[model samples]
Target: MDERIRHLGFGHPWLRGGPGAGDGGETSRLPWLSSLLLAVLVLVGTGFAAEGQPDREPLDVFARLLLLAGPALLLLRYRRPVVCVLGVALSVLVYLGAGYPYGPVLITVAVAVFAAIVSGHRRAAWWAIGLLWAGHLLVVHLLYRHLPPSGDAAASWWPEVGVAAWVAAVLVGSELVGMRRERWAHDRRERAAAETRRADEERLRIARELHDVLAHSLSVIHVQAGVGLALLDSDPEQARTALTTVKAASKEALGEVRQVLDTLRTSGAAPRAPAPGLDRLPELAEQAAGAGLAVELAYDGERVPLAPGADLAAFRIVQEALTNVVRHSGSRTARVRVGYGTDRLTLRIDDTGPATGDEAGGSGNGLAGMRERAAALGGAIEAGPRPDGGFRVRASLPLTPKETP
Candidate 1:
């Protein structure tokens, strides 16, 4: 219900005072305080104006009541701006018809008009102010002699021109204020949306980083563990080597996991170590060998410095592709090719053979993570079975610097 009212630009319908009482995103207690002040100003100002205009009817109980009526109606301007403006305008018209002295009394109607327009009720404000102006003209020009203070003559057209100008000024000023408020609201919404988008992108990046780190390390540990258990009884020495490889892989995995966690704990802090890049390819090949998979590394172009983002993406793509080969392929050999270009870097990993092993089935998140990394760096990844037999993954990453999302 509250959201519905806010969306309608009326604020809370039941709130008549305090913050958020007014409509169209007003959240101050100014309206409440201003209402009280306006009532007093109108009463006192009109009494003084009456002293100067001896030809007008003297101040009476009904005249004072009419002056206060407009300000009283202003209390509901925020929650019901259109209704408040109409009531205030009517009070102003009746006060004029009664031949009461005009002074700060018009101030009440101006305030109502401003509120109505700012609250997104522009048409209602126009009608109320327009009717008030027409009614004032009618009383002063045609009905003056019949209405109040005896011997009153009809008002001149020149004064009516000034009244029309005042009305136009009020309408223009109200429109300006409303437009400014809407612009401010639009900027705030845009900033909030940008913040939300950045947060989502950060979460996705972290998830992909964690997946690449754990998947490759765990695959190596799994193969070494299996070897250790199989040879434990007959060949203790070989089993010890396998155990050593498992321990090393697990320790490296934990280190990478801790590095990723450090980023979450320290906002905007420099990383304890630089992110892994293509420089780590040899280390990856060693790890794959420990998992009973031999990886052959080849280069196709002259080595050139890569942007940090592109380098990191290239390394991860190769890592994920090799990890997939280790888990899913029957062949024990995989080949990795790195091609450096003028504006982009290409990486291709191929394994020769058919599928095998219990680890052949996977959640498929590895390929997805690789694709996301390449895409983030304005690149693309293609993974499918090579027409010959084994599977292949080819990735092309731009060399351009990637802005932080």
Candidate 2:
């Protein structure tokens, strides 16, 4: 029921205000006021027309007032369109049967029909029109058979023709108005739904970005902090170096986090720094070594440039793979191999075996995050214990040719 009122442009503003409500509320009221004014004008015109025709008898004051009442009642069209239309139809019948001047009394019927259709009461509107037309035919038949005729009966049909045309015009106009209102409402709903979907997607993207950034950086910081504490008594100098690495890692993490926050604060209006890509793999290997892992990087085939999405995914996958190696693998050595091909880029990170301690149970989002990134770019990832007795992560990212400037 509420939706119907909204589509008809008559919903209460304070109860359900939103875009277009002001205009819609005003528009919905126009039909009611116009119907009332039209009815009043028709009542006044009937008096004038009756006075001008000396052959016609003036209607009693009570009958004229009743004719006026029909249109005034149209003020309730918005609240109860079907009832108002039916009431107006009955009043018009009474006025005609009482031999009142048939001036603009028909205008009241037309307005009632229009109100019913505009208010989304099509069946009621049609029924009211049918009743009016049948009554009109009956009145014409009575006039032709009982009244003394001065001219041909064919000429008397003109009034009925005019009334039929007026009713048809009202029906078409009301239907057009209703259709336009429905279309506008549909468009507004679609735009709102689209905006909601965009917001959801953006939130997911930001979540993935924060998860990847914090997880990798925090893992490195955790390992270096452990090293610093373990060597504090045995090798004071090495302990200081470990502490220094921790400070540097923390600073870098802070800077990256600030960048992300700035982007969010500005609503992405500010330009961002270049994203990390495959070129940063060597630097990543160095950082892993500083965290106590023995790291080696190798490449096979000719290196080719990759699109921005594929490049970022490849970099993140490798970063996550190496972080896992440093934290979970017990062995000291790990190998990273990049195999470039004509259609795709392949990355492999393998560690010797499982490590001791609680590192394995650390936040388990790393592998899942890597897989999400790879799948987002139409790539694939595989990570598990290798048959050679160590953990391995392999990712394949398909390449797209760079667009020419």
Clash pairs, candidate 1, are: 22-78
Scored against the true structure, residue 144 in model 1 reaches a CA lDDT of 85
The TM-score of candidate 1 is: 0.86
Winner by lDDT: 1
Give the deviation of candidate 1 from the true structure as CA RMSD.
4.6
TM-score for all models, in order of appearance: 0.86, 0.72
Q: Where does candidate 2 clash, by residue pair?
A: 330-354, 330-355
Cα RMSD of all models vs. native, in order, equals: 4.6, 6.1
Q: Put down candidate 2 lDDT per residue, 1-405, tens digits, no spaces.
A: 989845654445412322332234543563556766776688778878888755544677777777877767677666567766777887887676555566888777777667667656676677777777787677556653443223314226667677778778888987898678768878998999999998986776667677777777777788888888998999999989988887877777787777777777888476477777899988887777778887889999888888877887788888888878777778888999999988888999998886555544457888888888888888899988888788889999886765667
lDDT of 1 by residue, 1-405 (tens): 878746744344323333323444553433668899999899888888888998887888998889889988888887667668888999989988888887999999999999877776776788888889889888988888799877899888998788888999999999999888768877988999999999999889888888899989988998899899999999999999999999999999999999999998997888898889998999999999999999999998788777777888889899999999889898899999998888888899999968885644456799989888988878999999999999999998886644555
Model 2 residue 196 lDDT? 96
Q: Model 1: residues >4 Å from true position, as ranges?
A: 1-30, 141-153, 357-362, 401-405
